[model samples]
Target: MTIHELSPQRSAALTGVIPPVSTPLTPDYEVDTASLTRLVDHLLAGGVDGLFVLGSTSEVAFLPDSHRKIVLDTVTHHVAGQVPVLAGVIDMTALRVLDHARVAVEAGVDGLVATAPFYTRTHPAEIELHFRTIAAQTGLPLYAYDLPVSVHSKLGGDLLLELASDGVLAGVKDSSGDEGALRGVILGRRDRRDIASFSVLTGSELTVETALWMGADGVVPGLGNVDPHGYARLFRAASNGDWEAARAEQERLLQLFELVNVGRPRMGLGSSALGAFKAALYLRGIIDHPTTAVPQIPLNDDEIARVGKYLSASGLL
Candidate 1:
């Protein structure tokens, strides 16, 4: 049986608010260790259950290999295991992902999150082998990041459930944005046979209450990087069965989510998002610089002012 089956309690502990952390960069695009240190402390102070590094929100697609290592090492060192750190080993193929996995393992991360092989038309069986191969190579627990928009493939509930049952997957971070499909996976894991432990974490930050109410184990909200306390409160309220309070918190977060849209038309979605996240952090004085990776448009003063307004209205300022 899988380790999760052998230790069911450990699986239960995986549930809660785990935010996908944004990598704070210096003006020259280097990883700002000081800002990152502050960011981790910020999350922990907000009572986050865990930290996720090298995710889409961290601009993993734009970071080079050296920068990726810096981010993993810096975050893992700062977090110091106070809470579990799940590192994203995202790549275009299984072999490429293993390279990242090895680094994460050496960095002392608690878990690995990977996307299905992308940039090539891969068969379903290959995809299955992809996850199984990675799991076999690294003894660390594996999480499937189901981000269809980025991976160009949607992992069906049946496949994910089967993987979890067989011990190849420990959890899923569903960024697919398809509520019905995610609910299917959530409910399937509940009804599926021989699946002892699995986590269902939603990446859609806007409707966290609905996601939690539908039985998601937790959230990996990108917005959580900006206001970890808000997400934490939402999770606590939901866990306490305070749906009314949870709904109110989620509504406020929905308003905060609007900050991401402050940079549009002049930049791509990815640029806008990373820029907005760093900009918000800067406005809050959590980070010194709001520099995004190359090729991503920076938020102008006017756009950043809009982000400040969103933060103020949400009471973050």
Candidate 2:
């Protein structure tokens, strides 16, 4: 069922470890459907509650529109509603975002995740209008993807809270890298919102335990592509109030997260991070080929070995 259906089960699907899945590509950089299926199965076996496709980690912007549809159709059909599927509509305008949203809906996603219009100057009013228009046009559960890194616009806690209260948003995926802002939104959701089911998920993998403690609903860690089981365990520990276990898990996961840094010396942040994830997955034998989309520099043999060391240290290998 779509998130708009709002059944008891649907309300609950928005919570827990929903990873922004990495896109697996063939050696020639096509969407590897077989590898994609295996990755989905790997995540399901790892006990993830849901999946967020076409996000930053998924290389949505680098993907041509055709490949984006391939990913949506492949994931949505393969998942078969085992869990809610939230797909990103990352674009530069509301109308352009709506174009992607239509495909997401056609592909059978349960919800839509979008960011503020980017590649141009925008005001808070335009940002709000962007989301409002998408929500009205799509009629799906709309999620605000607050990532200042790519969109270059920070969405404040106040605007998100207002949208949530206004019934234009179903939840938020805050990758804005602002911890204090995240806490403000979580607390506001807890204390001010009339709706009890509005989810507040953080993209900060390292601080997920603390975010949960502060009343955030769940997490969407890109690192989860390599270690979904670890993240799932951490979320459960936090949910059960075992702060000690949560911290231990978070620390271990942070160690695994160090792999992202291994490639930083030679590549841009996105390339290094994305390449490291694919290398880890390839080492784990999850995805057959670890070829990243161009022109993101692919990790060399040396970099892949470094990634293995990080995975080995974190018990991912």
Candidate 3:
């Protein structure tokens, strides 16, 4: 299908939650479609604005292309228009990303969330060209995913505006965690407003309110994989300018994020953020097991105990 006029169809106005959903797997490590479907349905009921499938939390690197297609098709068909769907296209090469975007759109995705090309550090101009090329190829609204720590590209304000002027670049997921950098993008290049507008979304729980105050449209949080309802409420509070309520919810979510995230000293590097999320999911009885693909370890006993205690204290379980 030829696509044009790439305006965002997502809830990109910063008032709801969108979870980077986990890819449920069986004991043999095959993608468990039924479990994944149930998890998606559960989050939808919990009031998530949409689903970001095959995200970093989903271990997209572990799944082969064939498996990715299966998950994408299943999700798009099963969703049946209940909520918008965004497919993660995290690839090391622009050509590979373009192929993934084409297939995802054909499978009926509403939009695409593409990470900067990893495996190499490139100049800002190179990064802009890479994204512009991809956006030009696919008509889907492209969210510039600025996860510098993961993908090694820092999306600057001028570059963001440049991509936006080309029409395919829709908004940004500012996982950079730099409040100043996010604000620059939000305030940068107002002249390009004719092409499309950029919405800044944050990855750090520490800077969500800051991002929202700076005009972020919404969040694509990893923790939302397990705590959709809490995030939904939090987003609503932030949107309505309910600072007190939003602050309280942010504190609660930050606590949960720290307990499971590997960046915390209590957990260490070998830990899987994905596993910690699945552990929380199991506690909630949302999924059957905390399964991971090859080379990714499951959460240990101490980690499980820590998660259980934290969730209990927060009454999330």
Candidate 4:
């Protein structure tokens, strides 16, 4: 149960399409371990370079402590060092995040991903302090997650670079959708001599190709959970300098990404997207159920049909 060696060395750098994997749930909303194992197999079979558990796509914000532990344990145990498993320590504050990070480390994640503290107003200085404290306390490599929509505060490029230079962070998982800022981070790392081996991964699924073209190190596309092969192919094509093939693959994925919107009219954003992913997994027979966590609307039969259409159109069916 203790998988300490999975932690990345100081010099280790993560790259390629790492999916923020979905947490498969049963009808009663328990963490379906069998389904989760199958999901992990599905992604690995599709050739993903790494796996991210407890991320937004995995409904980290909604899961209780027990549920989160089950997810982390299941993923790391099943992965068994095959690929790096980055666990998200998403909570409302530094102390809470540290607690989660400790659990994740004990569970044997290769790295930790965290968003800026949310629910309470936070200043730039507090955000910097937050990461610095976590980095100092936990020896595991840490990646800052920039998700303004959920965290309510954007990680500024200056703050991020400062932390990177000080060795407080290994990289950033940017989902802020700010291309200019993303480019700045990419270029800053390139130009800074003090910052070493910082991996920049874009969480923007739709703009993955552009992010690559802009010199991003990798991608953490949530959609990769649904089609890891497509994202892996896209990453390979881009990394190999085949822009045309990469573009084609990216466009195809963009079309597939439209499934996230199918339930928007009847549910919240998380509900629609997560529901769509689970639905896709179910349709593919990768998971047993498509039920999302409570308080989030589940896709009705009609919405599920829309997901099917997107899958069939994308040749996944």
Best by TM-score: 4
Model 3 RMSD in Å is 2.9
Show pairs that collide, candidate 2: none
Best model number under lDDT: 4
Question: What tens digits encode model 2's per-residue C-alpha lDDT throughout 123-210?
Answer: 9999999888888777778888998988889998889888887778888998987989998887787766355667889999789998
lDDT of 3: 0.76
User: Any idea what lDDT model 4 has?
Assistant: 0.90
Error at 268, model 3, angstroms: 4.7
Model 2 TM-score (2 dp): 0.95
* Candidate 1 per-residue lDDT over residues 158-265, each given as its tens digit: 999888888888999999999999999878877655664788889999978999999899999999889999999999999999999999999999988988888898
Model 1 worst lDDT run, 10 consecutive residues: 1-10
| Model 2 clashing-pair count | 0
Instruction: Indicate the TM-score of model 4.
Output: 0.96
For model 4, how does the per-residue alpha-carbon lDDT over 46-117 read when each residue is reduced to its tens digit? 999999999999988789999999999999999999999999999999889888988998898888998999
The parts of candidate 2 lying over 4 Å away from their true place are 1-13
- Model 1 TM-score? 0.96
Which stretches in model 4 have alpha-carbon errors above 4 Å? 1-9
Q: In model 3, which residue pairs have backbone atoms overlapping below 3 Å?
A: 14-217
